[model samples]
Target: ALDQEKKQIEKEMESLNLAKFERLILEKQFRVLSYLIEDKKEKVNIVSCDELNNLLEVLEQKKQRRQDIKSHLDSLNKELACSNFDFEKAMLYRDLIDSEKKRLETVNLSIQQLEEKLAEFERN
Candidate 1:
């Protein structure tokens, strides 16, 4: 029954590996959800199904806001291009564009930081 014991051990190893993989996925999801939900005061270590659904809704809202900002920025760029002959309007558009660019850069940096944190968390 040595062969039987060997097969049992292999099966147990596979099960353990699967459990670890699932845990990693859950942890990553939790981190992302928590990071994106910026207004929440408490950290959620273990999320219920309903909470996950709420987090997903929040994610969609944030995505929509980002899209709106991008669309506004694009329109500003177009306006800037068309208003080159009007010096005052052109300068105003340029300033607006600069502010939007800075905002976008800040958002990008926050995302980068979150990813770095996730990687560090995984390493530990």
Candidate 2:
């Protein structure tokens, strides 16, 4: 279910055509941010003042990317959640398929059991 939701969300994002660019930018920012965060966490003596400032700028960009991706993803999720198929009909179809699958499975199991019994009787 979670995977289905994720794919649905991704499909909607793809339809909007922003997901690709967002993904690309977000990936780049994430990689850069990881490096910058490591730099910031290093011993103060290891990083000069200019390097620290540069790290801060990258952090800011990472923050912005995080916000944008979250907002866009949230909006897409909401839109997908609220969008409707005919609930009654969809549910009916779902139930029908479920019932058919269960019936088929039962029939298959019965056939297997009968075949086993027949084989045993034939061997006797």
- Pick by TM-score: which candidate is best? 1
Report the lDDT tens digits of candidate 2 across residue range 18-119: 554356444444434543453344324224543444444444543454455455445444544565637764454354344434434543454455455445
The 0-to-1 C-alpha lDDT of every candidate, in the order given, reads: 0.52, 0.46
What's the residue-level lDDT of 7 in candidate 2? Answer: 62
TM-score per candidate, chains pooled: 0.46, 0.32
Query: What is the Å distance of residue 59 in model 2 from its true position?
Result: 70
Q: Each prediction's Cα RMSD?
A: 20.5, 23.9
* Native-structure RMSD, model 1: 20.5
Scanning candidate 1 in windows of ten residues, the lowest lDDT window is 41-50
* Per-residue lDDT over 1-124 for candidate 1, one digit per residue giving the tens place of the 0 to 100 score: 6446646755665566465335434433443343345424212421333244444454454455456557767977876676544676566567667766765665565445545554555576
In terms of TM-score, how similar is model 1 to the real structure?
0.46
TM-score, prediction 2 = 0.32
